[model samples]
Target chain A: MPDEAPNDPKPSAEDSPAKGPGNPAREQEPAAQAASEPEARAAEVIERERRGPSGEPVRSVTFAERKRMNRRELLKLVPLIAVGAVAIPAFRQPILNQGLRFSDWTAGALFGRHRLAQTYSDREVAPFEKFPYNFYDVADPGVDLEKWTLTVSGLVQRPGDYKMDQIQAFPKVVQNTRHVCVEGWDVIGNFGGTRASDFLRWIGADPSARFLEVTCVDGYYESIDMATVLHPQTLFCYEMYGKPLDRGHGAPLRLQMPTKLGYKQAKYLDSIKVTNVLLSDMRGYWEDQGYSWYGGL
Target chain B: MAATVAVVKQKPEETTTVVYEHPLVVRIAHWLNAVALLVMIGSGLRIFLAFPSFGPRIPQQNFFVLPPRPLTIGGWLGGALQWHFTFMWIFVGSGLLYVVYQIVTGHWRQVLFLPRDVKGLWPMARHYFLFSPKPVVDAAYNPLQKLAYTSTIFFGVVSTLTGIVMYKPAQFWWLAWPMGGYHFARSWHFFAMLGFVAFIPGHLLMVAIHGWNNFYSMITGWKREPEYLE
Candidate 1:
């Protein structure tokens, strides 16, 4: 087999470093070298050949030697077999979980502390009717609207139940922002609420708490990272399109973070806890099942 | 392109020659990427099935027929996401390794399709499709083969870029600007998958038609009596 350099202008066997002076083959192939050529010139020719246009060695090896070389090359690829471990039932979940966790960690790291989610103008907001009511269990979890008070606990200085008016006491913020679902659908809707940071400060919640865990009127629960909890756009939403929350939309108070997936925005807020630790088995409703915990963006 | 040819003599009149083809790095990256692509495509289809449309949630309009269950991987949406997320790193890693290696080694000239290759494409296509006279074999890859391989890099770039936007739309929102927005990026990501779907069958068919020695070369980095060499 000739070592052909298709586009290469000069092809010569002398370029091969494998043909060293000590090699018997070099002595046997001495016919190519001119007797009149000085040793220094001949050495330069060999050096230039060794560094050929592509710096690729041009050589010939016996059939048996080729087989050995092929075997060695094939061996180099054996590490790729480790990727097949995902096929095993026991290993699959753990490996995938690690991958998801890594992705979540990256997402969390990429999340800007003060950066706000993209806000849209009023005209760009999706029609109220167009916003689909997505829920895991029921769209309208029956909550006594008048009696409903967000039960605050954990690391907050104020650990008592608070009425909707108390949450509404903070200066109101209204903005249109896109809400993305884990299923890949998205809608820009008008949301009215107080900044979660302001509300956290009012509630005397510890500013440095690592996570804010929340439960819903329904069985669904979620834990949010403190960085997101303090984001200006993270809202304890009480109104949508300037109307008080409807039963279908988590009524009294629900998390309305523009930066988080719809699932992380727990609706029909029941209790809130500021804590550093999350129950291993109970991260979030969908997250425990498989969804990424850092449902950022 | 650091290829070596070796000849072995079995008898006085019998001699066989073998040529190194794929480098070890290329072989490793190729197989790793092959596995990653299979997982990515399979799991991606399952993820797409959750919504199956680019339209709004209300008055939803599905784009096409749902992919058959057998064709998809992972049992459910969440499970499919796990597979997709897991293999994404591998896909990107292998692609980067292959590309960086090609560039650093200056081996890209062997397979990268350039403007100069445009003229040879018709002749090669005619040879393959119309059963015309075989074009003279010279390089490891012909113009059409170069085009096919080169297009994959384009598809890979599109897929990875769109994937990043979809994965971190808020953080990488600027990336979506060129493609229009997050919604359009999703569509582009799906289309990129379609590009691979279109390429796979033809790629496999060509490999099958080329026989075992050709396929073995990818694994062993050597081809026995490659026709181009003859």
Candidate 2:
């Protein structure tokens, strides 16, 4: 605010001429009383009439010429009609969708590969009971934990149903990170899982794939950019608070990414596909319904 | 500012003077930014309705009476998010253009409130609220007008910065630190909106009091026989 202080008082003082109808002397000037005006005041009026607001020469014109000038100035604002298109019901949704897509693209571009989400100490983690259960459908989708296997397909060298033990075989990672919801709520909790990058490497997935699409037993689906999918903090989560994930928290396996919104951290993940293209009609569960797909924090 | 006072000859006996009060860039940015700000406020309220609190979600304390539905834009949370995300670009873009233009043209001097203007504020406020004698002002804007206009710039900066932190918290984690982290930034964003909400009614009322000629100046950049000239 201090930097905004003006340099000098000279400009304001020079502009403060008392030459308006409010001044009795100026009011009497047009009534053939020019001889009665003060010499200094008459000189000031002549100087003011010669200059424009920005010190340009002022141009005298006819009434018709002034009207034409106003019309030309008004016409230049016609381009703003594009914004008014949003008021039409038919155009609203599409326009908004495009905007969201643009935002998602920018979010993807800003995503840092090595940048890490802030990790909390054990004491900073919210209690297990404090973590709210959020799901689009039923919390318990009734996945048979013992018989469950991750079905991997699409652009992976190894494409088949893989057992839980096989995924758990990768070096386990335990960290406490914040989970942010699109609703503006957030919580920090302890999560244990293997690095998603490690699992992708193990499955020989194409590193250049543009997207990682996942489907959940609860019917929730999500598509993540390859950059976020391969981030170091991204995890194939299997446990919470030192215990295996419960039914309410996407039992067996879920995606736990500190960098993504809760909706993107899909729970009860049934299948994950490494793909270069996403289905046009179904990008994500909440996303298809109008929520931002990028859902990055 | 000195009146431009271009004489428009109507007849041999009579003439009128017009002043170019606003530049074309300023006029365009003003109207567009006005629309963008309205959309931002309406959709922002709807988005806030989803959580409606600044506290921990576990305890779930409600902040205030929920904003009535009619006052908000977009029918639901998802719908509101779309509108909010979309118009934010327009809001930021126009606001930035206005500021950069003001600075580049040295026109900010007309509106930016400075320490010297502080003494004149009480007199302007007294004139408006207490019906005191109008204080003579030399510049394009009086002290109180400058205060109100200048505050919006502050609000714009706060809202946009806090919004960026919330939008990409992880990517801009360092940005959140100065605001006491993400939670405080959200609160700051809300407060900034409150500032806008407070400003608009007074702005509209003043425009109404000034009548059509003053209002038309914003649209056409010229005021026919401006009050000061008259």
Candidate 3:
């Protein structure tokens, strides 16, 4: 280890040479030892040189002679790094851009459903058909539309919130999909709702929104990168199973973000906001508190 | 002058090597390091099984006991979380104390981060693989070993930070900002697991190459003759 930095300022990392015992004498010991290393190495090198006819020639390679790495290696890293650099910046644009990620991720989630998944065996319009998802007993979807307004705020141009009915009018598109939870559960359901992207686009959100933070009426919330939101597997749906969607599920409106874990799917839509910067690690009400926010398998 | 003249005619003293390395606490800490690494890896696999798919879709096999989410290990997920965090503190606490102990006791000098070591990596690597001429007899650790140990410490702290971010994100979420976010923290946590997995095998190989005589010294607190150590 001492051989690593031959010129480090620390003194010789070994036994101290004997000196007359005194306060000042010991005070100068480190300085005295510090002065001895190069001299000692030189003495050792000189002694070795005197003994052996050939020692490893000082340094066979000089720094100037070194060449840059080969083109192939550099080429391989370019695309990967470039993608990350580009995508990461997308998350830091501005507040108006905030909900864009949610739009994109939800849009991607919607795109994943091949016509709203396979319909349930009981296509008889069971309102609470999507009931008992996983084990969490929270999130009673008995949502009231009068109080249901998505608060679109944070780092945005026009941060005024929109009501669920207002969002529903923005070019509704329903697709069937299999809701796959990371807990190894998959449910086939049909969800009809306004395209979150269409709604975001209608709102004319900032193009640079890189992160999407969503808060649900029931206090459920999640966040995701813009690219992930737009990955064609995300969805924004108001109808589930077959019928006019009961409030038991995330009725009125809920997101089915497929690429990520189910936790990102905030039920009972409360708000959408554009953000240029991603949430600080300290953000995320649930995830920040260390429940799996990614919610994906 | 008289003392120098008197010593000039003196006979060479017989050298009998003595070992002075770890005290009992430090020794306990070291063995804990070895043990904890193995347990972390074992439990880490159980956690990874939940994902089932990862970078490159690499197929994985479960080894030993398979459990789930380190936090809630047994009631639903049981003992794994307790074991993981419990030993995690032991591993980390001991490592921290050992470092402070080393600093206060001045063992840091013996292992000062060296420029020679930074420069010696390739040569030390080459020497380790026998690609170069015999390795220089390092007094403590070779440059490469120093680098590896330093990186291990760095990763150890990172592992702890990421673990905290994963565990109590509300309290330690600040740690995740430098990395990326929650997902990024999770990625870092997983990668740290992989790093430990990779490092352990390589570590054992080095130990084997260096011989068990030195390896056992970690337990016995006494090594075989350390050549040229005087």
User: Best DockQ goes to which candidate?
Assistant: 1
Ranked by TM-score from best down, the candidates are 2, 1, 3
Q: Which stretches of candidate 1 lie above 4 Å from their native place?
A: A1-58, A136-139, B1-15
Q: Candidate 2 chain A: worst 10 consecutive residues by lDDT? A: A1-10
**Alpha-carbon runs more than 4 Å astray in model 3:** A1-297, B1-16, B53-79
What would the DockQ be for model 2? 0.36
Worst 10 residues of 3 chain A by lDDT: A46-55
Residues A1-297, candidate 1, lDDT per residue (tens digit)?
343322222455343333222444543342244345433222212222332123333233334455666788878888888888998999988899999998899889889988878888888899998887876254577899989999999998889999888888999999899999989899999999989999889889898889999998888899999999999899999999999988888888899998899899999899999999999777999999889899998
Point out the worst 10-residue segment of candidate 1 chain A by lDDT.
A39-48
Return the lDDT, model 1, position B16: 37
Lowest summed lDDT window (length 10), candidate 2 chain B: B1-10
| DockQ score for model 3 | 0.05
lDDT of 2 by residue, B41-89 (tens): 9999999999999978989999878888899998899999999999999
lDDT of predicted model 1? 0.80
Best by TM-score: 2
Put down candidate 3 lDDT per residue, B65-98, tens digits, no spaces.
Answer: 4444442221221123333544565567767877
Tens-place lDDT digits, model 2, residues A1-297: 001111112343244343332444533343333346432222212222223334322223335555766788889888988999999999999999999989988888888899999999999999999998875255678999999999999999999999999999999999999999889999999999989999999999999999999999988889998889999999999999999999889989999999999889998989999999988767998888888988997
Q: What is the TM-score of each candidate against the true structure?
A: 0.88, 0.89, 0.43
